[model samples]
Target chain A: MLKFDEGKVLKNMEGALKLRPQINEVIDDVFSRGFSNVCWLGIGGTYASAMQAVVHMKERTELETFYENAAVFLTTGNKRVTKDTFVVISSVTGSTEEVVQAVKKCKEIGAKVLGFIDKADTELASLVDYLISYPLNEQLKFFMVGDRFMYLAGEFAEYDEFYSEMDQHFAKGIVEVEKAADEFGKEFAKKHHEDAIHYFVGAGNQWGATYSYAMCYWEEQHWIKTKSIEAHEFFHGMFEIVERDTPVTIYVTEDTQRALSERVARFIPQICGNYTIIDAKDYDVPGISEKFRGTLSPFILHAVNNRIDVHVEQINRHPMEIRRYYRQLDY
Target chain B: MLKFDEGKVLKNMEGALKLRPQINEVIDDVFSRGFSNVCWLGIGGTYASAMQAVVHMKERTELETFYENAAVFLTTGNKRVTKDTFVVISSVTGSTEEVVQAVKKCKEIGAKVLGFIDKADTELASLVDYLISYPLNEQLKFFMVGDRFMYLAGEFAEYDEFYSEMDQHFAKGIVEVEKAADEFGKEFAKKHHEDAIHYFVGAGNQWGATYSYAMCYWEEQHWIKTKSIEAHEFFHGMFEIVERDTPVTIYVTEDTQRALSERVARFIPQICGNYTIIDAKDYDVPGISEKFRGTLSPFILHAVNNRIDVHVEQINRHPMEIRRYYRQLDY
Candidate 1:
């Protein structure tokens, strides 16, 4: 893998899985306290991550869960967010103004805030009632929180077995996924890195990954213009702009909405000759259960894309860390 | 105005407002019968329309309201939707496949279905329990149903007065808005109709309009490529792709999320040399109350965009009704 450090990646995943006991403890405490509902708040990429959790929660559990944009929540202030609400938040930088302010307000409203922060001394860590600090996978942390809550509530019975498997083999599985995808990622970047723009489509739990990758990684990190559309909405209006030479990517997952993206995949080749389909079913996670593929597809797909990001940076000659206006210039 | 029939628009608006009494009656009947929650279902454009309604419902009322994509609803049935749920839907052609299927399933589940159809006879019209047939403004009809429900629930105190004012002068006020926006619309289309692509940013209630206009009209109707970003998410990752010459348009409204879009509007001029700001505050709806502007900004902003759509059609030499894929071919 180009520009990839396997040791560091494995270490991060191991550290993330190590937080399982703490996550279980926090979720058990919250369940014992008896909250009204679950509210997950974030901005940008984290918001997209929360959306994935909300989709899974809606499908598998009867819990009333809301994934709200932190900035909008700050401005509009959800009425359902009260003293009995269990608010979950995450911030890697720990200095995102909107996240900090939202956490402050959530604390003021007497809601129990559980936050995953990267540093122990960050403002967000101080504001949250329960803080889990680690440079770990945010997606795994989110699902840990959600899975534990559902397990306690009797909505998810296989939670213990699932996490036990994840704690052992998930890091090694992610590394294998990246290695398997490196060749295709390099080819994709080499062929279409300089295209006018890119179009991405995905559905089910993978929609959030598609959205975040297009905006947060391609656009923000590499300054590549891209449009991400939900597979269900792809035929509605976006298909009209596709030509024979247009570059497009479609993600197919093993979720219930697999048919939705499969529909897009079937049609894209008819109109767009330059298209790629990234199917999660193609990758084999050594020790994970087949039934849990839908639940873990987003994380697997993201690791696959990380390979593409490395190749894109190397081939396009654009460093991933450059920014024009974000935090560099004031509005 | 170029290619615009003011008389037809005025008559359509007048006809839509005429459904006030019937909408009120249906809402009253549903309320008296007592439903559990309100669910608005649609696909694509209609889904975007339902989103605007949901934003208002969340802000003003305590009623449990959900705006769901019809396709997703059919694929993954909602646990909240039951016999006591009130499902509201609309289809201009009244034969959208996913919508018809969802409505049929809802009926089978014993939930009451209220539909707005433009024709008296269609598959969807037959599926719904309560049908309102007319060629009316979907946005107006949506709000009418929502306002009536809120008024009955005591969430909206001035509902009757607001509807009375709308009946008297809303159509005429809309005509004034179009007339007022004609020159700007013409100039905007003349300058940017040939641009490689367009980027739109909007927040709060105006976000749905921005999304629908960008994808539904620009891409589907005119074959123009465009990207629409929610204003709050603008700074996160999308901003990094914007250059000095990007053709960006920001929509500013009077809603609580006004500051969100205003931030984008203020920053665009600093980054992009060629940018446009469509502020709803500049438009005056003569008969509507000043305090109701935030609630009405989406309609006002949409009407303003309609003017631009007309000019874009004329200036770009592309007919708005032409479609390359949508309904023209089998995918």
Candidate 2:
């Protein structure tokens, strides 16, 4: 629990959860008034965070949803984007340059823009047609941003029952996450303290979390060498690099594609000497149903991994806030 | 030229080119009729190869094009896939289990399945509604598969002029790739022969080739540590790992988003001690108009990297064909 603030984490998470009703209303309004398609645009970690929700919307609804890098999308105009299209863009800080430009472009196209940010006075809030601003504290930014987006997407896709369940049990879920993190964080750091390359694997909705954690936390924050591969694609090419002592982290979610991760989990231990499997089923959610657990797996796994981030930061003596180049230098 | 058979490469590439007219006819027939949307489904390298074409289609055409992993798609069924949907699937062997399952699922949904394979008698050829089979020699497979897919996608989007120019000048383009590769590959091998981790950066349509080369050739074939990051996403997180001696390869394509790659190209040398830039513009693609070169960048870059692959294979004494786990073990 080094540098961990339990009260702040709970309060920020609760603040995000409280936005559910407002987000649902906004989604309902968009749905009631017909729209052509939905586009999710963000930069870096924000884009990675929206991936699972985009996948969920694509799988569960006929609505055409695109998850794109904001800068790339601005430069390469999507033919599907039009006046009737609805775009949802997110940035923890509403002043991200690429996102600001994206919002401007969306406005020129006359598309309805929904901006998600931490402050209402920022440029994005001024440009977007609607705004959902919340406090994005460092402790809970990833989980809160991911949760809000997924909840909105689910509501738009008419998963009312699932949304209701998430609203009811997520607060309780965090308590379990805190307890589990305190235990797993120290253990993972103790075993994986050396300077080594790590491979993180997940499937289904959890793939986004796997990717985000690998890039945003491990590589960006800690300067660790890591590669995040989807479990479905693991055996194809990436697995060839695995040795008996390779460090591999497997996140097994409760989704339908759990079988895919299980397949990898079964195979890795046979060939890899150091492999850790973190299953969402190990964490207890007091009121959440088994079927609904799959939908909320990304949020839960993210919370668990966030703790690992804290441990890795402490063990390495590398403050998570330190950046060698990201915001320090001009590209 | 270290281990390359120029004549065989030319012959196989020419054979793949011969299928152009047939591919055009099929695409024309499909477009002339109608389809709900387009789905590009593949696994591993095949999936990575199709990324650029999918992006091109999404940007240029009104049709909703989806690029997805075959196994993931099979497990999480897309709501947009229906009887009217047009699904394109590819595999060199045509016997890939996941691809076969995908073809079955597409057939079950009554979708029009387009299968690209190396042989006509394969299972994928039998299951698909339409089949395009050609000789998939080691040298020509990457360029041919990518070219064929991009060509079909471009034709559907009505890029007749661009396609016509590519047809007239691609053979000449290969010759230029040969010259550049002969020069760059030897120099690269001489300096970086020792085993070390490499970072590959690419933007626009060339991102697929970058990912494919890093995973398939570098990681899988040579057991080298490599991470392929999109140029747009490089500054976001992965760039933090760069140091004075980091080995980085930047692929600068001649596309609309050339500036994105150039941005990274500009920054790397200032911060990193070792960086190699393989710009598509360096090769003189004879008879190919400047406007059309962007579309053919991936093919040219692939040919250039193919030489590097040969050099890496020679320097490391690692046969590109050797497998540690891929196809050597069952999952």
Candidate 3:
């Protein structure tokens, strides 16, 4: 009962791209106002997007940065967070146990709290010190999963040049995502039939995608053994593992340092017991320059990933697996 | 030449364990001075130690930490240090391109610098704002090959209650390590041949050991493939890669946490194309822990891991491998 089909996500993504520059300006303004350290807090797709931003910021800035699990806030009673610290708490639905608790912690610690939410009235928006809003529309296949909304969070900042370019690209992104989703669905299902285990590899920020599509959806939801690894680091020795029982999927993006990305992709088939590549270019994304418009690519890619997650749930005859080997993880 | 003979390391290691409490106290003192963050600077074996220590600290403390390649100081011309940040600089020789340049950065940044050194008059000693001594007497190995020095460090932290116990158990430990090394030498060499591919696995602090011995030393020295993975985490999905083409080695402690350690060991042989297990308890690290003491296990485990590195290098047939890779890694 969603108003927009998966294809419509392509346009929302364009709008999201248009909003990114503004988001960056807002972030920079807050960053200059006096935060010395940055923390990204979220779950699932938003969590993944947060991770990507964390890694990118580390490479992009010399200052201190971290990705914190909301659980840390819930558990640590004596934790010290100061006003000099920049804490970003996000959730697409604007409701999650850990995130809610973390916002409370950030307030107590006197840190600036920035939030991104899909709904204006959501709890996350109500609680954060500075909140940014996005469309609340849900029930859409892609939106049902979180993260695409993160890409939509770009309007909160002052950086407009990049957003304008992304705005232009957003209109056509939906078809590409559907195409990517359909292709991925067929390929993933076909591979799932042959192996009980699956592995996902994303280097650097790709871990964001790897964690969501592989660990959360594929492995956690379907009872498949899914794993993620940094790309360049993989070849030094892990090549031996790929040719065995694990069939790995590689997430390739245009923004990945070109040489490193291609080098890792080329080596995948060598070590993977078997392998497949799912590529997203800037053009294929809601914008150009994989990173220029963070809003468009992550939301589009994650939505496609989400669509496949749904497809796998539908086509598979296997039992639904709810595994709790230990309490450290959740689906 | 080092003052240590074939058996002298065992003697000093025994001596060092007697000094463990003060050693343990001082190790924490390195970080107690209250900086906003820490940057570990070093090269080669010394840098290797810093790498292991930084990771251990990150896993232990809530504080932010990072590693600065000793070489980056050479051309970056960036030295903005402050009370908000500090450096823990290490040097076995006190003379390295990056280590020397780091001193200049420390001066430029106006941040306090702590030098961890084997010699009092090293270049690093003269420049450091605070100095920590990791001295080895003429009767001991100094910075030469063999891990007696690092092992003794482990003993430094838990010298009181564990000294006599370690003395009683050490001969057995040495014998076991020697036996494991000899057997490991023959089999591992045959499998790796001249390719220089190796894998190391450890859990908890042992993961630090794996990173140093298996990844840093093996790969840096030989331009080979060496990777370290968290033992328990590796099995969640990665074990399927162990095949005939690649081999793995693991480091374990006798009193390893029961919940995780045992399960990982049980599955080792199933996936390691080839594998070996060396318990820190029996790894023959003279000065390190004879038995798990009250302090964190990393202190003891890291020293034993250092010893394994020396032993592996001592047995390496490719003598020039280290020299060949040095240029690519010298910084």
Candidate 4:
């Protein structure tokens, strides 16, 4: 595998699994303390991740769950976010200015904040009331918090089966998915690395992944021009921009909204000659129940897309970490 | 005003105001009949408009309001959208497949639907329990419905003053705004109509305007490529793709989230030399109160951006209503 480090991957996945007890404890403490509502607060990519969790919470529970981007929350306060609100936030750098400001505001209002941070020695890490160190598994960690809370609230009945299977197969299955997707990723990167612009589409839980991958990875990391359309919104106006030779990719999930992107997948072939479909259903994750496959498609996608990112970076000769303006100058 | 029709604009705006009595009657009847929650449903541009209303509702009221794109709602089905749910939807064509399907599902579940349609004879008009013909005032009509509901529930104290002012000045003031913005719009279109791609940034209530203008107008109507980034999310990744000569346009509003876009505006000039700032504050609605200005920024932006659309259409020599794929071809 190109640029692949199996040991580090396994270590991180194993570490995420090891945090189950800690995650459960945090959820238990938050429940015991009693919260009026749950507010998922994050900045940029983290906000997209929070949106996925909020969508899940809305589907499975009657719990009052609100998802807000950190900057919006900081500027325009939510009346629902009060002292009794349980706020969940995540940061890879753990020092994103907006997230730090939002966390400070939450602390000022006495809201209980559970923060997932990669770095343990950052401003956001110190601001959070309950901290969980999730160096690699951001979405997995978020699902653990949300699903455990829903289990206690009687909204998630399959919590036991889901996590039990996750413990057994998730780490290894994900690595296998990465290796499986490596070849296709290389071909895709080789063909479309220098395309004028890439149009990406995804639906259901993968919409956040679609948005984040396009903005955070393609635009920021790879310095590529791209537009991400929600599978549901693709037909509304975006389809008009498609041509026979356009570089298009539609990500299909095994979720209930599968048909939404499947609709795009079917239509794209009719109009676009150059297209790619990254269906989560194509990936095999042993030991995970069929009923719970939809819930984990995003993580499946993460594995598949990580391979593509590696190949794209290598082919383009552009380091994913290079940035022209971000964190280099004061705005 | 190149290609502007003042008469048609005034008639449409006035017509929307004239529907106030009918709109109030529908809301009064819905309130008397009782409802559990409000669900704003639409596809694409209409969905974006509903988002602006949802943001306003979230800011001002504690009502259980859910905004869902019609396609997603049609497939996944919200458990919260029940027989007692007040479903609000808008469609220009009123024959959008997914919206009609979602409306049918809502009907099957006995949900009362209030639909805003431009055409009175479309299929959606026959399906909705309550219909309001809003040919041009989609956002205004949505605000009327939401603000009226909030007023009836005692959540909006300034509702009386707000509507009274809207009735007096909204139509004419919006025309003035359009006229005021025509020269700037003409110059902007002349300068950037042929740019490779336009990057649009907006926040708060005006974010919907930003999104719709970029996708519905730029991409769909004009066949031009564009990427609309939320103001709060701009610094996240989109800013990295912006060069000194990148054609970036940031939409600013007078809402609580003003600071969010303002921050983007402040930063864009520092990096991108070829950037346009379309500030809603620059275009004033004479009779509207200062306190209510933020609430009407989307409409103000509509007036401003409409001028830009006219010029872009004229400059690009593309008919705004011409579509290669939309209604002409069946997927």
Identify the leading candidate in terms of DockQ: 2
State the lDDT of candidate 2 residue by residue for B1-331, as single tens digits: 5777777777766667667677666666776677788787888888886687675554456667777788887788787888988787777788899999988998999999877777788877999998887765322333333344445555334355655665676765686688667868877866766646888999888887788888888889988888889898998888888899989999998887788899999998889989999998888888877766776678788878877878878888989999988887888
Off by over 4 Å in 4: B32-34
Best by TM-score: 1
**Model 1 chain A: which ten-residue window has the lowest total lDDT?**
A55-64
Instruction: Judge candidate 2 against the unseen true structure and give its global Cα lDDT, from 0 to 1.
Output: 0.77
Every candidate's DockQ is 0.74, 0.76, 0.08, 0.74
Question: What does the lDDT read for residue B236 in candidate 2?
Answer: 88
On the 0 to 100 scale, the lDDT of residue B231 in model 1 is: 96
Give TM-scores of chain A for all candidates.
0.98, 0.91, 0.73, 0.98
Candidate 2 residue pairs that clash:
A244-A273
lDDT of 4 by residue, A196-282 (tens): 789999988899889999999999999889999999898888789899998999999988889989988888887889999999999
User: Tens digits of per-residue lDDT for model 1 on B47-113?
Assistant: 8888888777767776778788887777656777889999999888887888889998898889999
User: Chain A in model 4: its TM-score?
Assistant: 0.98
Which runs in model 3 stand beyond 4 Å of their true positions? A1-4, A7-32, A42-47, A72-80, A92-97, A117-126, A133-158, A270-273, A282-304, A318-331, B1-37, B40-64, B67-295, B299-331
Candidate 3 lDDT over A1-331, as tens digits, reads: 1123655566565545445444555565664575666667655455666666754443334555556546433442223256777676556667676578778878878888877666778776888877666652111212111222222233224334544554565456555666657756656675564454565666444556676556455655565545455454344323333444556767665443334445667755543456777665633554555455433444455655655655566566544344333233331
Where does candidate 2 stray beyond 4 Å? A137-160, B137-160
Model 3, C-alpha of B265: deviation from truth (Å): 17
Model 4's alpha-carbon lDDT is: 0.88
What tens-digit string does per-residue lDDT give for candidate 1 at A1-331? Answer: 5788999999989988999899989999989979988999999999998988887776677677878889988887777788999999888889999999999899889999999999889878899999999985888899889888889989889987888788888889988999999998888888878878899998888888899999999999988899999898888898999999989999998877888889999888778899999999999899999988888788789987988899989888889988888899997
lDDT (tens digit, per residue) of candidate 2 on A1-331:
6766877777777777777677657666776787888777787887876677676554456667777788787777777888988787767778788889988999998999877777898878999998888875222333333344445555344356655766677766765686777788788887886657789999888887788888888889989988888998888888888889889999998887888898999999889889999988888877777767776677678778777777888888999899999878888
